[model samples]
Target: MPNTPPSPRRRGTARTDALLQVTLELAAEVGYAGLSIEAIARRAEVGKHTIYRRWPSKAALLMDALHRVWTTDLDHRDTGDVHHDLREQFVRSAAALSEPPIGPVYRAVIAEAQSDPALRAALDERFLHTVEQRTLDRIALGQRTGELRADMDLTFATEILCGGLYYRHLLTTRPVDETAIDNLLDMFMRAYATDPPPPDRG
Candidate 1:
């Protein structure tokens, strides 16, 4: 007989999700430097006060958007092979980041983080930290199983692998394809793989 209204919590969640979606779209369309809370309000069909209730500043809002867009689960199956696993994971990651919606959004976030300390901290805590942990965990697992070299600095090695992806993605116009991924795996794996136990303990 009468229409039902959503609870305050549901309404708030919906509004926040709408704002995040609009924020990402606008970030891709106009870049983060060009984005404004007012523009987000207009695009999200919400009022400025509504946005303020959720996020105090543009950087805060963009950090949330970065977390929403990035920080995803990996689909690479562990075949007990580190090279194949990292290759599949990285190729999938590159392909995803090279696409339209996410590609531009990722570039914008990274660019904005350069000058924004809060944003950079957010990226480290939410995005980079998680990725680094996953990569390092995978490498450690391989080392424990003799699939990778235990002598190498896992943290630095991890950075080289993932950092190369970011460097090529943002700084260079190199095509990120299977061939590129293979080459990356080749270079890193050579240095990363464990050699036979030196014939005898020294």
Candidate 2:
């Protein structure tokens, strides 16, 4: 007698999801250097072949997981006020970086990239480039819209705005907090000072 059931491919997909979730969870618990595909397979409760079938290499699998939560899109938004928009972006960006699971993952990835050529290349080309481009674009936009001083060097501005948060986070081991956001906004606005004069229609 024939039995009613889903196909083998559907079952495989279900197993893949379980493996990915378990992989991310394990990555959070243990640093990337300590991760094991075998352990992931066991924790996921799927066959080892299942994990291998989806992601042939550990780095590829890990990168895939990272991409899902940390988006690469960071287009600058012109909110009519550069300082206000930048402040808002800092708060949101800092919060994202501070997510419990994500924070540790970033630490581990950065360390690994320093030693691993493949991972370093991937990080620079795929992730870091996107972040830097977004930062540069925001500063340039501020100047173009007359919100920043025409003489301000945007390359230095982007570094000054975001680099401070990174260093402070490293020192304090605290997520970039509201005070950091406020300080960045205040410092940049004061430095840039391009308040548009009230216009008259005669």
Best by lDDT: 1
Pairs that collide in candidate 1 are none
Q: lDDT per residue, candidate 2, 16-133, as tens digits?
A: 6566667778899988898888888788777778668767666667765665455532345667667777777777677767675567877787789878988777665656555666
Q: Write the per-residue lDDT of candidate 1 for residues 145-199, one digit (tens) a residue.
A: 7778769799899888877766667778877788878888999878778666223
How does each model score on lDDT? 0.78, 0.71
TM-score for each of the candidates? 0.75, 0.65
Q: How far is candidate 1 from the true structure (C-alpha RMSD, Å)?
A: 5.6
